[model samples]
Target: MDRGEQQLIDLVNAWAKYSEATPDADVAGFCLHYLTETAQPAVLNQHSPVASPDGLYDEKWVESLTGTANRSLTEIRPSSRLAALVGRLSKYGYFYSKKAMFPLNFKSIEEPVYLIVLAQMGTPKKSELIYEMMVEFASGIDVVNRLVGMGYIEEFPDENDRRSKRLRITEAGLTILQECFPVMNRVADVAYSSLTEGEKALLIQILDKLDRYHAEHYKLSKNAGFDEVYDRMVT
Candidate 1:
């Protein structure tokens, strides 16, 4: 057997031992963590460890590894349960946001824009707000204009720069928020209704970590080469 095949066998054996030793350890997650933490440079450079030239050479080795991995853990692969939960939550959010805004004459697009304007009240420039919200400039401009036309948001010329405008929520907007926020919050409460307070806190902590990592580490520049740019960015 080749060195890579031997390594795979050894790794699988080690995982089997560990899983047997700790019945409650998330075995699938343990496997994924091990693979990620101990990933070799060759695998990093090549992208796929299992499909690499040095990896499992034939169906027999693959079957052997599979059997070994499953001996201690019914599921040996990573799962999408978290992602599926998020997807379901997204649908709930969409439905609730639409329903919550119906009374205020706010649609899906306007609801988010209104919330952003309400939060920013007096400080950030409109352009900065749009960029922070990660929306297209033209689309954001339209929403801002609509909000202004509705008298929910007021704009003032930036004192620092006469050419730019700063946005703030008006009394009308504040009143609307006071009336609607509790209802909107109820929608969120419904989404997490099944989770205990402890579970909610834990989920928030985990999701926050993911959010920070994704925002800081997963950004890609359109101009840079794929491998070099991404490797340097994440590293």
Candidate 2:
């Protein structure tokens, strides 16, 4: 429709072609998946102090914005699968690229606030390690204290020990996410509109497969070497 939408569509179609030729190539997957995974941590560390234990950027939000209407790739016939896949993959790419382009100014809030929020939101309520955030990106406590002062987050009493506290997303914090939705959706539309329906589906399948694979192997892959590789590829 608009120039941005056209650019996104062209990008998705190109990526679909690239992925079809190299299904197992980890470079593309690494680039896409890393951003997908890192957005939560980056957002936590850079934005507000909301820990997204489930993951960064809600899946439902992604699907709704990307026009994926709750249907799995397998459910679609081969003729239309590619288009759907492309749309989804391009959407993912657009989301992280935009965030990377417009990184939050963490001068006031510590950079690790986003990661702390992510850790709090993660399943089982696990506290994300400061070391892990350092590996993701170097951060400091002054920034963290600043975020607390700014009202983006509030302290939660740790269930295990009264002496400790964890961070939780406040209603205001959720409002930030709500505000971001339209910008993200606009980016996705720009990334996937050029393709025929079939090409888009293929892109979605490839990315979904990559995501599943990453989820399965994330524990082994969460090392410094992997982080370096990801940073290099994405940049």
CA RMSD for every model? Answer: 11.2, 19.0
RMSD of 1: 11.2
What would the TM-scores of all predictions be?
0.57, 0.40
Cα deviation of 60, candidate 2, in Å: 39
Badly placed stretches (over 4 Å) of model 2 are 1-150, 162-164, 223-235
| Candidate 1 Cα errors over 4 Å, as ranges | 1-88, 109-113, 116-118, 215-229, 232-235
Q: Any idea what lDDT model 1 has?
A: 0.64
Could you give me the TM-score of model 2 versus the true structure? 0.40
lDDT by residue (tens digit), candidate 2, 137-216: 33434444555575655677788877776666566656655544565555556666778876687668767887787665
Number of residue pairs clashing in candidate 1, backbone atoms closer than 3 angstroms, sequence gap of 3 or more or interchain: 0
Among the numbered candidates, top lDDT falls to: 1
Tens digit of per-residue lDDT, candidate 1, span 86-196: 666777687877887777787753554555555764667888767666667898778878777878788898999999888888788777777776777777776677899
